[model samples]
Target: MAVGSVALAGTVSGGEFANPHLCQKGQQLLLYFRTIYGKQILAGYNVYPHTPDDYQQTGRHAAIWGRDIQWLGDVDEVIAHVQRHGYILTLHWHWFFGGDSAWTRERKTPVVLDQLLKPGTPEHDTLMRELSKTADVLEKLQQAGIVVLWRPLHEIDGGWFWWTDLQHPENTAELWRVMFRYFTEERKLNNLIWVYSAGVGDLKKKPPEWRRRFYPGDQYVDIAGIDIYGVDLQQDETPYWDYFRAMEEICPGKTLALCECDAIPNPDKMVAGKTPCWLYALPWWGCPHPRRSVDWARFTMGHPQVITLDELPLFDDASYAPELGILRPADDGGAWFPNSVPVIEGFVAGRGSPVDLLQFLVDDKVVAEIRHPPRDFSWTWPGDLHGTFELTARAYDAAGKQNLSNRIHIAVGVRNAARSRSVRASSGTNPEAAVDGSYYSGWHAAKDAEDAWIEVDLGSPVEISQVNLIWGWKIHPAKFAVEISRSAPDDSERSWETVSLLEDLPWQPWKATHRVRFAPRIARAVRVHAYQRAAHQTWAGYDLAEIEIPIPAR
Candidate 1:
């Protein structure tokens, strides 16, 4: 759903900028010169594997994704490239999916960690050792003053990463505890900010107890992130926006992030102002199509609600991309610029077939439409070009359920940079569960074509804690114990190992969920992989409500 057009903000591409400033939010993007794309390794123009046209390309890590990269250039070569770009050098465990879902060691050596995620094994040890090595790399980056915004173990709720084997919550916590100790305690490296992210999935519909099983708390993460990609209005984008609103409310005290994001497609659509549907119920806009084009730089430069590299890059002043005309004052939408009225029309949401998301800027009185006739509709400029407005669109299906839209934003006279907002906003609400301290219940629901969840955090290190589930009020609540696993903080850098099983206790009103706390072996986090383990049931299904752990609160 995320997509946006790139503006080679007129920086002398070859040479680095002489300034040393972290690109602050709301500032224009100063031209950035990087040879990598996302978190994967990329062979720069001076390195091997660089195509003849590498110089013409926008990013270096163009095609690579995942851990265990086979780089043609060594870390020194990477440093050299960074010197040339002279902005902030960026490296990431970019793609943590596919091919056994683990780190690949030797360049392109296809070593995965999927098998290692399972309970109890030597492979798990190997994973931990490898993580220590990765920490070494992070340490180096830290020394460079290159504030690395490393997001290693992201999207935990999705059963994709090594720490989330649904059957091993304790193991997950153990792994996090080990990672935290290795990085924060042993390594003594603190120049980096850690981000724990989840896909922009709804957590509201889920029961409170089920959401606590995978709660990696504020103690572990520096920034609580949610990966939000823009969506084409042609499809429902409620889920993405809902996450934004939820975070605004529940995580008011925590720093928020669109840790990973994509601009909704069609640079033209943004020309007008805001997306309409967002004014209403948030919906998932994952229609089948590639509306993802806008890069992170463009987005951070524009939106200030979320924290991004521009907010704090190693090199000062690296945050803003000034050349994109982002800092310039908007000239009343249509009347001000040469292309002011240019209509921006295309798929704002992913629809089965392409749908029109007609948009045009307004400066004075000029008008432009991005879509052609027949498909395009008409509208007029109402108030001040840069003034915010709640726009409504008209379209309907046979049922008149209304293929509708509504959004709020301002036009001309706004800041010159795309980031300079004509309006202001808050991060929004979290899940109902967070209201009480039930972690996931409030803001971390998994509502899609999948089974729901429950999770937890041991608070501080503790031994095999009792994972008590309140199955029912009756006979020995079927035996559904909470499982656990521990992983390296950078789960992608290593793997996971199963820890133990804490079984059921007396049923509580909060569904069949609760846990026992002891002066257990000290560890950091724990997760309960919900399961329907008791074979003999009339319904033959698993159901859990809430999860609790008795921790000596810090």
Candidate 2:
């Protein structure tokens, strides 16, 4: 089938899936991919059996895809299972029959691409039957109001698949075109958003050649996706950036995605690196090993940029204005101090109409309202509120329609005392490290040091209500005292007084934070004296990750 012959009449405009709304003029798949852009990214999970019902049970991903459908009964059943949830569905086909019969030892060499493409050949007939079965399922889904992010012949640039070992790279492209024609023209499956995906490893092994060789052309693809693994997921390594940029240069106008990842990328690193173009990421599932921990999952999914399954909108609602989406004091990362005013911020992506007003809600009650809100809106909470609270924002369009944003869970308490403070140690140590705003880096005292002392300069005389200390590995203090002083440590007129004393502090295998609240004291400097060191398996000196002091409201 000629690629040009396929009519574009029923092709779903990629723009329809862009933005927070169903159908608005914006970047394609931006709603699902870059919902938080610079600040957050969307989280997705792939499950075994690939059924929508099973995915719903996990309650993790905003988008779901499946592989190994044969193991889950039938392809149509899997499609039906996924269609029920109306999720952003992606499908992966592991073509084991390419050449080596790894699944079965019966076939060693798969038929050549030329033979498979030729009419009246046994290989051609066999391949057609398989394609017809998939197309049949997709046709049913199309009739049922489902659009699939269909990724067939994936990882074809890698040598592991039969399709990848074709005599020439053009042969693989031909195979892709054949499959595209069969699904779109022969079977009339317009609900598919064709994705041209390749493995990052193959791109590295083959370099620039692999991208050009395997590409099926812009006319045949809507999104360019890459499968990445076996690297540090915590950092945005060079390989990922290379492939991301290559896809943009190679495909030019198509959207980009992380088709399959063994380790989810760190949200902070992704944002810091400025590669927010990733529309969505689907991490391969099989816990406690290649998959990330529950903490990592929670952090990524709860980020502002990431849209989980529960957060995604119904396909039918894409044409309307999206419900308000919270932008600040992130759901999981946000914290408020007791007796301190906390500001809540969010925005509604108005679909064609202007937003008339925005109402900020605390525990379902309207706390603040803004008329004719700007592109973004914010409201400050009453300072007296304490304990845990839930926050949400609602927006009203010009027509008076209302929509609510996601809920943010926050705790009102004494803020971190050590943040944004200058520190000095009595004896030589990396005192400044403790206040650097990172858990991995901390202040370390001299080896076997005893009676170690660290002092913090608040830069001004402020009322302090609490002191929080975070201990590093095998370096907790057994006894400590918090002291306050009005003058510099070296000043002859300086007066120091103990404000809080802690004894017999417990040790933890992992770093832990200990909070101590005291009667509010006004001072310019605070000191922590370690009277004794806990029995250490390694070093006996003190090590502190952070020192937090919360100032009470006036």
lDDT of every predicted structure (CA atoms): 0.34, 0.63
| Cα RMSD to the true fold for all candidates | 26.5, 13.0
Give residue 302's lDDT in candidate 1 (0 to 100): 37
Write model 2 residue lDDT over 144-167, tens digit each, in one string.
666667788887676566677445
Residue 263, model 1: lDDT of 30
TM-score of 2: 0.51
* Candidate 1 lDDT over residue span 360-430, tens digit each: 33322224333322332335443333322223233322222223232112322322121111111112123
Candidate 2: what lDDT? 0.63
Model 2: how far residue 484 lies from native, Å: 56
